[model samples]
Target: MAVNAHAASARTATARQPRLRIMVLGLRGVIDVQGGIETHARRLYPLLARLGCDVEIVQRSAYYPRERRRRGWRRITLTYLWSPRTRIAETAVHTLLGVLYAAVKRPDVLHLHAIGPALLAPLARLFGLRVVVTHHCADYEREKWGPLAKAVLRAGERLGIAFAHWPIVVSPVLKETVETRYGIDATLIPNGAPMATPRRTRHTLRRFDLQPWRYVLCVARLVPEKRQHDLIAAFQAARPPGWKLVFVGEIEQGDGYCQELIAQAARDATIVLAGYQSGVALHELYTHAGLFVLPSAVEGHPIALLEAAVYEVPLLASAIPANLALPLPRNRYFPVGDAKALARQLEVMTQGTAATTAERRALHAAIRANYSWRKAAELTSSVYRNVARGGWQHG
Candidate 1:
């Protein structure tokens, strides 16, 4: 008999509707305040809940006593210890705790996020748990891991891909990488942004005391791989008189990338570093900005870029194919790592062309019409059901 993972099991008549009891694993707890994986899970869970799944979002910290949650700095320290390399020991200490909590809560499927939780897959299988892994980052051989850590993580990724019942990926570049490197078949499900409604009332824009000026907005972690330094150089070279350059998002650990960027901006009145903004402030910034730019050389799929697109803010980004793959038609692209080329693109946007307005509208409509969280949630829910039913097939 043949099986289909895409469809729910018809054999069990008692199964009125597949109760997707999903145990979500990955970057849980405090790390979420900074990373995309955390944000994705937080955004996704409530949508999944509404979709009729019995969902339990598990973080390693859940195993901690209530008293531990109150100690902020100590909690952050413990989280780093819970990183993937240590997850074998970490999971041993906490997976049972995670599972016991799930059992009491009674979940039906297991959906794990991030490469970090892949270390626990072998154990998840031992319990007859169905597994689905969302391959979020590119995790290119060059980027993550030092000499020894790279080799270990590369091997771990291979094992994670092999063991997963089904793998869900965020971009074509990632799906292609997994297929070519690990022979893992993955579903290409792009990331979605919240539908943007610009909050650009006179009061809102005036509250920030900004004049009608064209500015470029760049939102990404201030990390080395993000190539933000290149962006600063490009903005300086472009030298648009009234045009300001603003970068949103926080800096990563040990990297003085943000400080370097600030130093570069010191002489330039046009370049400003607005440290992390969320809620209404973030939305207003995106809405009011003339363009959104991201120069990241490494990405699974950036949520910030997606948010920029949904807002119909004209995008000026690096030429990385994955960044381009997100249905952005009005975008202006520059060669990766080339500050000069990026500067040229910025000049064109600032100069203003007849095509800009039309292109922006078309791109905005395309994103809103196609990329939606509801659709992503529904498709992802199907993957969970497929794995849980033991019907997953390898490509």
Candidate 2:
């Protein structure tokens, strides 16, 4: 049977006829380039709009003066003074603004993206608005919080999970955590990446004057948990001839860990600190790299890993369950946080172009066929409609 383009376009047009006005309460700052949640919003927002959902990512006003912000200093002093619940007050202000904005602007469905905004879900419902929340992280107890603070955080997480009309989780791992720990049932919607073109041009690599097929790429935030310093050290110790390591991400203050990474990089010319690259630059780096490595100790199924899979750069990633869940070969994973183990894995991938063209195409097809923003939007729309019809029940 032959299908007509005209009819298909018409069907697509009609299928998206119902416009869903949605306001997404986001954390990691709307413009923060370093966080995964922000990257997810950036990729999904336009697609949501195309799917007939009016999406707005709510952000907070800068808490400090311009000079301090420019110098990599956060307003931690002020935030610390707020004591046991600094984020609550900060997030409440944003949520209040979001709720007020929603009341006036009147979005049909209000979606909250992180734990902070889940604190406002009950109020959003009280104001006669439909609510949705996406849980983006693991148990707060896993974080470095004090005993009293962790207890409060855990309680708050349970409340947020138990009260939302629809709670969407990013992985089966997170789904289990929520169900067992908070007794909240959630639908698992894993992370995805936009289909990327392979880098066939020298233009992108030329910008940094890097040699083609000679550098390994690691794109992530420069945080302790990300274990980027491990990548730096591994690249240094391996010191593979004709191979370099490029780190692409921005660093925050007080973490002061960026300096430590730079010092480690100084011992080897192969390691380049490229800071933050986005849009075309980021895509190009993923496309042109010899291999992509992720040394993260913890992640919620990172989008970078998906991007690497899409571009068919044989990934040498952590041995974490999330990475294991992907269809990559058993040889791709290294024990988490072991630089030497990571170096050994890198040696294997860098040996030669071992992956066949068919394998590359298969991996790309796997990600595109199984995971996409269009499919995400469809599932989300169905969930929203179901919740609107009162089918969704929270714990």
User: Which candidate should be chosen as best, given lDDT against the real structure?
Assistant: 2
lDDT of 2 by residue, 1-395 (tens): 01122223432653756766666775544343567887777666666565555555555445333443332112111111111224335655666677777777667777787676676677777787777888877535343345765665566566667778878888777788888987767887777768786656666688776887689999888867778878877777776778888889885544567888777778766778888887778778888888888888778767888888888877788988777777777877899889988877676667778467787778888887766765665566666555655666553
Model 2 segments beyond 4 Å from truth?
Answer: 1-18, 29-32, 63-93, 100-106, 126-128, 139-153
Lowest lDDT 10-residue stretch of candidate 2: 74-83
lDDT (tens digit, per residue) of candidate 1 on 1-395? 12233323332321466556676766555333555786677566666665656655555554444566433331122222232324235544454455444445445666667665565656666666677778888553434246765555565576567777887888888889888987667887677778787785545346544544377888776777788888888888988767788877764435566678777778776677777667777788888888788998877878888888877787877778777777665347778899998888888777865136788788778877766776677667767666666667462
Task: Tell me the TM-score of model 1.
Answer: 0.81
Candidate 2 local lDDT, residue 65: 37
In angstroms, the error of model 1 at 218 is 1.0
Backbone clash numbers for all candidates listed: 3, 0
Clash pairs for candidate 1: 21-107, 21-108, 21-109
Position 364, candidate 2: lDDT:
81
**How many residue pairs in model 2 have overlapping backbones?**
0
